[model samples]
Target: MREEYRGEKGTTTTGFDLGRVMWVRKEPSHDGLIVPKAEYEQEREEYKGWIAKEIELRGVPGQLHFKFVRDTMRMNTDGVLMVVDSSDYAMIGDASAILAETIASFGNIPMEVIANKQDRNDAASPQEVASWLGVESATGTCAKDHESAKNALIRLLKKLE
Candidate 1:
C-alpha cells in the first residue's frame, strides 16, 4: 500500500505488502439504497439519516507532497495504523512529530502504532518506542514476517470494532 520506503536503519527487507494489510470494502449503497458516492455527498431525502455500515481503511501515502490526499482521507478515516521503523533512531523524531500531528487531526479515533523491523538486532523494543511516542503501547512487528504483520493488524481491527 505504501508508495515508498522510509529507508529505516537495520531494515532487512521491506515487504511488498507492508502497508496493505487491511481493506474493508465500502457498504453496498447500490443494494437498492442509494450509491457509494453518498458518503461524499448529501443524503437522499428518502433515507432520513446516514448509517455508516463500515469503515474502509485506505493507505495514505507517506510522501510529504501527498498532504492533500491525507486531508481528504481525514473526513472518512475511522482508525489509523501508523507503522514506525523501530531501528531508525534518526527518524524517530520525525515519526513522533507526525504521530502527534496525526492524533490531533483525528481526535479520539482509534490509532495503532506498529514498531516495525522488530527482527533487527538494533531495533528498539516496541514498549520503549511506545513510551517515547507517549502512547500506552505498541505492537512489535517484522512486516516481512507474515504472521507478525497479520497479528498486529488483527489486534488493531479488533480495537476499531
Candidate 2:
C-alpha cells in the first residue's frame, strides 16, 4: 500500500471530505523518507479514505481509481484553485462572470483564463473577458496551443508560489 500513490488534482465540489487541503513542500533534509508533518499526515489519510470510498461507490477498476487518486493528489498539492470555462460554454451563460463570482466566493487566489474561440470583431479581448470575470486579466490563450496553456498555468503558479 505504501507504494500505491493515491491522490487527486483539481478542485471539486463533490462531497470529497479531504478535511482540509494543504500545501506542502519537501524540506531540504538529508533524510531518506520525507514523512509529511503529523497534521498533514492525518489530513492525507482522511483524503485517501474518502477517495477510496468514492471509487468503490462508482464501481471503478482499481487501476483507474489509482489514477484518479494520483491526479487528485497532484492537484491538491500543485494545482491552483481556478476554474476554466469558455464564454460560449452553456454551463455558464457568461463564463467569465460566473467564474468571477466563483472566485470571489472561494476567496481570491491567482486565477487565469483560456478563452476558447471568444467572439470578437477584433473587439473581444482577454482583458474584456477578465474584466467581465472581475479577475486581473491574464494574457488570453488559445486552448489548441500547448505552449500558451503551459505559459498561462506557469504564470498563475509563479504568482501563488
Candidate 3:
C-alpha cells in the first residue's frame, strides 16, 4: 500500500480510488480453473497459481459518504477486503455492524478480514481480531511493509479462486 509497486502513498481514501497491478504468486497454489482461449484449449497458464493480471483496488469508505457509496457501488465488485485497526479495540463493534451491513447489502460474496497495524505494541493478533469480528480468519498485516500488504491481497485472491 506504500506505493512500492502500485498505488501512490497518500492519506485516507474517502472515495473510490483505483489501483491496477499485476500480482504474481506461486506458493499457496490456486485450486481453481482458468478459462483458456478457444484455440489453446489445453493450455492452463492462467490457473497455474494466483496470477491477477489486473485488479482495481477500491476504498469504499466507512464513514465519509458511506451510505451513498454503499447503496450504489456493487457493480462488478469481485470481493471485499476489510481492514481494521488492530490497536483500536473499541472500533470492533462499529466494524462488526458495518460488516453485517455489508453482507446484508451484498449477499454472500467473497470477503476477507485483515487486522492491520500489526507493528503496534497494543495490536491484536489476527485470530483475536477474527474472534472479535466474528469471522473465521483475519490476515495479519502492516501497511508499511510491501510484502505484508501484498499477502493480504494474495489471501483474498486465493479465496476468490
Candidate 4:
C-alpha cells in the first residue's frame, strides 16, 4: 500500500502507506487506560513516515497555540478525530467547550467524536457521550478490540470522504 510521488513542488519526494496505528491500551482500573512505552515509541516511528510534523497543545493557551500551528503547518487536513474517554464524565464540560471551539474554528469540516473505552463497565454509551458533547453522533470504540477500532475508523473515513 506504499506509494511514492513528487509533491506539488516537483522536486520534493513523498510517500505514504495505508495502515492503522494503535497506540493506547486499556487496563483494568478506574482509569482503565495504559500507554505502553514500547508501543508509543513504535507508533511515533510509524507516524514519522506519514506526518511531516506534530504539535502538542493543552488548555486555553494550547488552544491558541493550535491556531498558530495550523497556520504554520498549512496542511490540507480533511477532517478531525476528537477522541473522548467514555468513562470520564468529569471532563465532559471541558470536552464540550473544546468541541464547540473546534467546530466553530473549522467551519463544517467533517468531525467524529470517538467514545473510546467502550469495554469498561462504567463507560458511557456512544449516544450518551454524543448528547453530552452536543454532537449529532459518536462512535463507540474499545481500543483493545481491533474490530471495534476498525469500525470506528471506517466511520470516520467515510465522513472524511
Every candidate's lDDT: 0.69, 0.43, 0.73, 0.61
Candidate with the greatest TM-score versus the true structure: 3
- Candidate 3 similarity to native, TM-score: 0.71
- Give the per-residue lDDT digits (tens) of candidate 1, residues 66-124: 66887887886667888888998887787877787787788888888999999999999
Estimate, for each residue in 60-89, the C-alpha lDDT of model 2 and write its tens digit.
112322545533443333334333344443
What are the root-mean-square deviations of the candidates from the true structure over C-alphas? 10.8, 14.8, 8.1, 16.3
Candidate 1 residue pairs that clash: none
Top lDDT model: 3
* Between candidates 3 and 4, the lDDT winner: 3
Question: What does candidate 3's lDDT look like per residue over 51-159, in tens digits?
Answer: 4344667677675348688667767888899889999998888888888988987788899898999999999999999999888999899977867877778777776
Clashes of each: 0, 8, 0, 0
Estimate the overall C-alpha local distance difference test score of candidate 2. 0.43
- Model 1 is weakest, by summed lDDT over 10 consecutive residues, at 25-34
Q: Model 1 scores what on Cα lDDT?
A: 0.69
Instruction: Tell me model 4's lDDT, rounded to 2 decimals.
Output: 0.61
Using TM-score as the yardstick, the better of models 3 and 4 is: 3
User: How do all models score by TM-score?
Assistant: 0.63, 0.40, 0.71, 0.56
User: In candidate 3, which residue pairs clash?
Assistant: none
